[model samples]
Target chain A: MLLKKRKSKEDTALFRLEENEGEIVLWSENREVSRQLSMIDLQEEDLLVLQKLRPLVKENIEKIVAQFYKNLEKESSLTKIINDNSSIDRLSQTLTIHIEEMFTGVIDQAFFDKRSKIAQVHLHIGLQPKWYMCAFQDLLLSLISLFDETIENREDYNKAIKATTKILNIEQQLVLDAYQKQHDEIR
Target chain B: MLLKKRKSKEDTALFRLEENEGEIVLWSENREVSRQLSMIDLQEEDLLVLQKLRPLVKENIEKIVAQFYKNLEKESSLTKIINDNSSIDRLSQTLTIHIEEMFTGVIDQAFFDKRSKIAQVHLHIGLQPKWYMCAFQDLLLSLISLFDETIENREDYNKAIKATTKILNIEQQLVLDAYQKQHDEIR
Candidate 1:
């Protein structure tokens, strides 16, 4: 059958991130993100809600990222992993991009792969799962507050919140699986 | 429970080969290699054979790689995809390393991902699946001949052949899945 071939391309930037002198927070406890990974049905409604939140997330990206770092930096113990202001700057940018990507509305195999890599990186840098989990929670709350303001109806706001939470939970689970996989490998 | 951490890494180099100045061969038709892919059992016997054959495949690596290239070059039309002598040399070296890697006795998810990338590259380069199938056939023969020479017992040799074939079949099936996925995506 005659079919036009699209140029196949693959970029594993996720795996390429080396042990840069950036924010590498070391927490005593790590969560196995991979083991906790389970398929959450991202229905059409969820996709719609996510897409709607994209602009709001984009607008608040800087503030959201700043606040996340602020929370992380407040704990003097955590600042040890931050390396320097330059590292925080880079990480803030990365976190912003990552958050922007989440709003793409379609999470495929590639998405999971990136999350898996992130989980591995956390393990590599001695980052605790608790911190990562808390960071995610903070991101969600930031988004939710914005979401609440963006939506007029209480019912719609609740639905959007539910959808957003489901997707984030799914992402968190996948990330944890990396920790689980790593833990298994080391054992 | 305390556990040691293992490093995680992934490289999708197979799909990274873009339109480099080289050979391009086009047959009138492309096979649905993906449709041809189905799960083939990899028995313990197969793993044993693969482990045993590892050194032999290694020993004859030069001869085997030469034969593979010779087969590819024989088709004057396919030579269009090979850029030059340097390209051929580089590809030959890569093929040798890849073949050697297969004998590592464990085909994990990472292995499948690499093979899948290779399949996608074939489609992207407009190389027909027929060539891959033929190349694999050539690889099988080269190994089988070596197997025949290395093993004194015919019965053991037959068992080894059975094992090797099973493993190769599994690899072929994975490569085919890429085609199937791409075909579905385009349609």
Candidate 2:
């Protein structure tokens, strides 16, 4: 299931040399390339753990997104942000696919770019960072609960949780890094 | 200091009538009309009280808006929402005008519609109702403090606060009413 992403930009221009994880990287100074790196944080251990947990997360993704929205609506403060039912459903489907793709354990430049785009969409709609944090917390808790239900082995479950968390942490880092850059540029 | 607002919308479209606060209001069913109303809930006593306080609120408006944004930025959650320095300055000026117009005691159809539009802008940007409430609280406290400094009579100070509060309440009501309508439609 390793889908190769298209090389988005032709690397013709001069790029600054940088070191990444004991490897030499020629980084383009272009804003897009400047913000991205060749680093994909998933390790062999994380990948193996994630591969096992992927199916469980996939099956429960719908329920997780539903519960997330339920929590959001319960807070009267956030009710105003909900669009029509159809739009919510659409966003839910998109998020489910996003989660499924995330568990693929093939992090790449496209993945980082997609995370940046998500940050941009939130910022464009004036969504504050607190809401994103709230969402991430909900998603984290939901996935952990899913694992708690299906996983039998304590040792293996612990491994799964750690791997899932590592990927989640990387996802968050990508988003915040993009957010800070855009925030600084706008300011 | 009653600055008369130019009538921006022509009453060409047919509007349904609704009674509010014992007044016969020929309200249009238009989204703008459904969201707005004739009176902004400022009573005669409140208006008279607000008239006296208007000049002072006008004088300290800049300081008030600055203090509002300053408080918003202090909260780590909201810093990401702040645009560049110049954009913040521009919005502050717009908000200052909005606050001044609010106490005009002229809460006509135009005022109601304008309040609804402000609600739309906030909701469009995914700004939660809590932030609006927080802002109103800040504005309210700032204005009351300003009145306390200038007004000698305790009774007049109390009256000023009441008048300001009544208009502020009406402003929230208009925004929330519009927000609900939009939320329902989108749902």
**DockQ numbers for every candidate?**
0.01, 0.01
C-alpha DockQ for predicted model 2 = 0.01
Question: Model 2 reaches what TM-score against the true structure?
Answer: 0.40
Candidates in order have lDDT scores of 0.57, 0.56
Candidate 2 clashes between residue pairs 3 or more apart in a chain or in different chains: A84-B186, A84-B187, A187-B84, B15-B28
Instruction: Give the range of the ten consecutive residues with the poorest summed lDDT in model 2 chain A.
Output: A12-21
Docking class of 2: incorrect
Over A1-187, each residue of candidate 2 has an lDDT whose tens digit, in order, gives: 1111231234311111121122212323444322222122235556556655566777778898888777566444345555622367777888889888767656556666798898787666655454454465556657766765565443454455556655665565567557656755675
**A89-180 in candidate 1: lDDT tens per residue?**
78888888998877666655677678889888777776654456546655665665565445544344445555566566666556664665
lDDT of 1 at A84: 37
| TM-score, candidate number 1 | 0.39
lDDT of 1 by residue, B90-159 (tens): 7888898999877766654566678878878776766654455556656766776666555544345445
The number of the candidate with the highest lDDT is 1
